[model samples]
Target: MAINQKSFDQVTGALSSLDRNPQAVRQRVVALEKVLERAFTVPGTQYKVGLDAIVGLVPVVGDWVTGAMSAYLIWEARNLGMSKWQLARMSGNAVFDTAVGMVPFAGDLFDFVFKSNSRNLRIIKAHLDKHHPSTVIIEGEKL
Candidate 1:
């Protein structure tokens, strides 16, 4: 499938805006949720909850929200037609970032270190490269 850069940018930019929305503002939540799953519970496994559980140790829910947003991006990638392998890789990065990122002060340290969205962006670009060979990949410079 041909991927349009305009559409891709718009979708991601909109998804990134969820953090600022008031609870009552949910027009895009349902639509974006399909592309992004952020639940307190990880389904089918009683033992495994999610970053919220791990990050709850902090004074506020900083790392938890960070991790959920990361998962959301991975979900967005699925909408972008990324392969399962890419999805796994993306999920793993998010998990690692969230898990290590909850350490008292150390976790926040790690969060600053691991940019999951940048990594996921790379994965998406790579997938696009492999699957959409006809499409030209443009850097900051002119193509």
Candidate 2:
């Protein structure tokens, strides 16, 4: 069934409001990081894998797709007023990941270990904790 224009507008409006909320943004970034870096566990092993590793198994296109996803974290950071140095560092992480990830077997292996999205998530969390304390979600507790 097709959604009516009014319903679509309402949904979009609600989403736009959430986009402006730091807490919502934090939650989104955290979820994306998990999906990108820690979504699956290997059988008979403690090791975890995520889309970044699985998708990077493809050739060059995979790296580029994941790299763009990584960029979203940095974009959100900029929206939150992160320092230039911080953004540059995050960008470097993404660029390095994409560049190295262009290699064949080595790049696939690197994708499994070098989680740039996780690193970027850490940076974003630190900034949020310091600047947007209200967005902080303590372990085992809902904010």
lDDT, candidate 1, at 132: 54
Q: What's the true lDDT of residue 52 in model 2?
A: 90
RMSD per candidate (Å) reads 15.1, 4.4
Could you give candidate 2's per-residue lDDT for residues 1-143 as a string of tens digits? Answer: 99999999999898566565788889889999999999999889988888899999889999889998999889889888999999999999999999998999999999999999999999999999999898888894656
**Considering every candidate listed, which one attains the maximal TM-score?**
2
Q: lDDT: which candidate is best? A: 2
Clashing pairs in 2: none
lDDT of 1 by residue, 25-134 (tens): 22232333323323334567543233344444463466677677777667666766667998999899878877776677776555444556566766765665566544
Candidate 1 residue 121 C-alpha distance from true site, Å: 1.2
The lDDT for every candidate, in the order shown, is: 0.57, 0.91
Please state the error at residue 25 of candidate 2 in Å: 0.7
Q: Which sections of candidate 1 miss by over 4 Å? A: 1-60, 133-143
